[model samples]
Target: MSPRRIVSIYLPHFAIQRWRRRRFGPQTPSEPDPIVLAREGHHGPVIHGMNAAAVKLGIEHGARVTDMKTLVPHLQVEDAMLEADVRDLRMLSGWARRWCPWVRVDGKDGLLMDSAGADHLWGGEAAMLADIRQSFGKAGLTARAAVAPTIGAAWALARYSAEPQEICAEGEIAEALSLLPVAALRIDQDTITLLKRLGLKTIGALAAVPRASLARRFRHHLALDANPPKRLDLAMGAIPELLDAKLPDPPLRALRKLAEPIEDIDNYAQVLGVLLPDLAEQMDQRGLGARRLALTGFRVDGKTSTVEAATSTASRSTAHFAKLFESHLERLDCGFGFDAMMLEALVTEPLPQSQHSLSGKIEDGIDLPHLIDRLAARLSPEAVLRIVPQDSHIPERAERLIFAGSNTDAAWPAHTRLRPLRLLDRPEEAEVLYAVPEGPPAQMIWRRRTHRIVKSEGPERIAPEWWREKSQTRLRDYYRVEDSEGRRYWIYREGVPDDGRGGAPRWFVQGLDA
Candidate 1:
């Protein structure tokens, strides 16, 4: 096996370049105007970072913005987004895994990759470094890259080397690092100052000092970077350094690049027919099924159109998934025709294999999940709803309407008493007349219509849930009553007369029994 090779990428103007890319486009060119990023400090706004233009004008990082304004009047200053910068850098490091599997974010504005035996894929170490620099340049970024046998040596060369791209051969770490300044060892500024004061300005000069003398000087320094000797050892491959690589999750998607742009729905459907089976096989290998899948068409004009399908239960059946997307195919707008297509499973669940009938017929009465999926695709997913029973005795809170595609195994509670076929969201108020205070209503007025009670059966009293309701909440006395026209209702009185919770009892029509 070849010796380990590490690549270090340094972005000197990462913050400023990221801000410019957001404000302008990714291919934005450098402007003559100076720009600086500032953050609120204890004293005032302090410069966090600056562009090349601002650096040439003598603006330094950590300098107060107010003092810098005195030197350059028309400076373009924006608030520093340090957190966003770090997040984007992390994302970029993950993306950098295209060059190698092992990639990590180094410090605040750099990336480290264990290229190792992967450089041959890109032609050589020189070509690999050039490709990295070119890729970053296309993204409107300035990148300085270096490759060496040791990560520490790669880091030093990437940041402090005169050339933007450097390749240090194996066994040449000492020769490459000797001419660099002591600051290139990544020590604290205070240590660099101390080294300069001791006539050890260069890394070579510092290395020539006796080990005993150098160890005695920095023996008490706890930080690894603070001790120049340790850093030197790490850079020279005397001590091994481990890289904490960022590994991204594997994407559950399949892609097809078309030889020609597909313009019609039939052609798109044909392509989808090919993609669904491929995607289903992938899910089958993992013993997983998709709950939601998205099919996206990449148009020749650099636009995308997506159509999504959701299953009532986890499913990997290619025919069923194809049928679900059939109703949604027309929704895709093929602007300038689609050059490529991709199908991705966004949400998934484990689906164990089950035995099928000998005749290949569904043993169950109906394929309700597949039927619901078709209906939801034909109409809207939101339009197809299922009433899920909630564990509440209150008529209004007894059940809820949810998307039919939701997976739930909650069964409706078995009740001895009959419940209304249709329950009102909120009880409508009613006025009772000619009825005893503690008895069923004799007559009731609701919605400006009067109803005489022809039959009545209930005075079932239900107490308020004390834990959930206020102590002053009243109890309910419900009655199942039939009016003169044979209309049935579930009505209730809010409180008993003189119960002390409120005044007279109020009546409400809570539901309609079928």
Candidate 2:
């Protein structure tokens, strides 16, 4: 075997750079700001939590927005978009696959590829590192590569040591990473700072101290040592694991349902609500958002149902999320009432937001959605439908009517959409008298109300769309007309005279009160 060349690729400046680009999205005025301060320091959009340019501008990871603003008076600070970041990380991971197949995404912003025999493809370790750097460089990414016997050492060297890429000979991981700071072990800030303050700064320093004392001083270090890839797989042994966990910048997840059955809809809702909200909060706490969610509802009756929906944008609001749940509730069947609902949100994306909540006037009203939910729960999801336009030429089928939650942005084409607020579920047949073929019904008796058409605008003929079975025998000449009461009516002739498709040339009141 050509040495197992485990490579760690890290993006030290991902969050900061992404924050800057989002803040400067296409339409910022020609302005001088803290970002300008970064530019002045010759920082080429490559700013990190600890880059000298960022430090000079006083931007620390845990620093407050007000303090950052004070540090760089013109600093254009931004809240992180964890959803977008995770998305980018996933894309980067797939892209990193070009480097090695045994690639495991590490934490939020790193990747570890088991290069092993693959390193020789680029001639050697040094050449491989160069190629990796060049590849990321072309993709507008700043990455640090390191090779080590163990994942931990490579993680430490890539992140902590600024020596670019560190390539260690096989089995030299402990020795190779010993000098790295305790922070290189990817511990929490308090632990790292505490270790440094206690003279336990480097990995070697921490390692040399009595294990009991070190464990006593920082219990987190012991816990970190015990962390594993899958949450269920807790680690054992003196596993000096990689300090970095490659988390996707884009979000995706798969979940399994539990054996227990959920009795109450509210109870079922409560567990999932608590779990999903808490998990999402953790993501938000980490500056992230989820754009898609999949819910797998398992019942005690050996039956399973799955519901999936994608958001037009990323979100974290519990209310907005409950709305997504409405889509799947019908299929859940409440079998033996549900045993469990395992929800997994994927296609995580960064939420687009401004600094403040746009500080606007608070609009007050009964939340119509809350009412809609109650109504939908009581009625057939399809019984009460909302009109949604499908992109097509057939008027009736041109728009689809679907359950009205999660999906509400249905727009109709203006040319064809002079639609009335109320349309009969099915057109109401009318007695019509027209002089010309396929012309407006001059006088029509609709719904027991006899009315004469004062004026008409269309013989706007719609030929039957042969592809659709329902529309195969239907042809209509739709007209928009106003009656004496100044009420507008949308009426259509179902069949034209002597047409091939056999049907009475019946008139119907399709829509009323445009």
Candidate 3:
């Protein structure tokens, strides 16, 4: 069970070390230019990545910002902060969970983790890759790491080895993946262009071909097994079956660490109300509850401020997460003063424990979930909404609004006619006036006002899910009419009654029945 190390890291100048720490901050400017990030492509701003002085001036990575400014005419470019490089790769995956709690990220500039059994608590695997490259060289960042026992041989020794850390031994993932390339078996680019037009270019030439013609010429099933103990147990570890289809990260977090640097926001709301009663007693001993939480403070000058809060269901209430962090604690930017706070539930559920009604009340409708958690903590979770039910028989695609306290049990569609209590968020193109395009319209103008119909019933037709979509729409009919100032509309007509598509069926109105 303990034989699966995995590290990987690799940042390859994650967007020029985040554009040289946002234009030189944690210092390093002795010779700067030659940057490049560009992005708008379709044949315009291409060069999506560069630096190491635009790769020593060859400037090639989908190169183009108009031919790299006609070949490094002092390059520099910029434009690709890629959402601040994915918010500094999720704050370096929350600072690599202080070293391994199975981190993963790995793409838009790598990070993989699973330092199995946690790299001997930071001392071996080359002293946890020299203390994670000295904490990414004090965060100006430029990591390269590799430790292997297979996350595809530590992502092929962290981007094909030049050793900023390498460690593979344990039947050496097929002699450290036989000198690399076959894109190190992370496969597909059409299997590395059909293994480079079949000269099988390395994973030791697809381990010398023939494992039933490498699974009938690349119908691949991991590491071309030409038998070296079945390609060393199918090439050591091509992502431990993608870390067993992911989802292990959240351990419901809490952290605190203050002792001093607090800068009163009521001492950060008295340390988040004494850390929400031990995070609501760890979500009430795991019957779980939280539905998105976050808090994170970390400040004393190295910036970190998160506040997040969302809920409509799962709730292990600590005065409902201190009224969901008192509506974003006055937008926390405690800058030079936080010294760590943390929280993190980031979504949880299962909350089971609610049977009490011998006249104590609560068969659902508890003050409308505390007035929708105080209007989603003072307005904004898409400003509150929530309809749900949508399999679509098209009454505006049969319901779905979502966002106000989400956790839907659904159940609302049972119409034997009469639906309009207030729908319209779109649907108001009326004008009709007809004398018989199949009866009932008698005066409709709407919004520019004309209405007369004094009482009409409906055509109520609907149709159009045509298995959800490929576009054809038209068949509607509906009508509930009632005008001459008695209001009540709901309209609809669209088409059908001579469905030969096109001309005169239009109408629309959709809702209003007070």
In order, the Cα lDDT scores of the candidates are: 0.90, 0.65, 0.76
Best by lDDT: 1
* Candidate 2 positional error at 310, Å: 15
| Predicted candidate 1 versus true structure: per-residue lDDT over 262-371, tens digit per residue | 99889988999999988888888888999999999999999999999998899988899999988889999988899999999999999887767888787684478898
- Residues 1-514 of candidate 3 have per-residue lDDT tens digits of 8877778888877777777678777676534577788889887889878777677778887767988798667777878888888888877776787887778687788888777887778777899888898888788777889887777678777888767778887776777778778665565466577567867677876776666766564343545432232333345653234453244444887889987788667888888888888888878877888878888888888889888887777777788778767868878888779988988797797887666598977667655776787797787767788778886677776777788777677787677777789978889887888686667888988788787887888787777666655565677888888888788888888875667666667888978992
TM-score of 2: 0.44
- Candidate that beats the other on lDDT, 1 or 2, i.e. the better one: 1
Better of 1 and 3 by lDDT: 1
CA deviation > 4 Å runs, candidate 1: 40-43, 253-292, 295-306, 309-514
Among these predictions, the greatest TM-score belongs to 1
Worst 10 residues of 2 by lDDT: 228-237
Model 3 ranges off by over 4 Å = 1-8, 11-39, 42-107, 111-370, 374-399, 403-435, 438-471, 475-480, 483-489, 496-514
Residue 219 of model 3, lDDT score: 48
lDDT of 2 by residue, 380-468 (tens): 45565777778777655667667665546666677744666777677888888888766566888877888887887776777777775
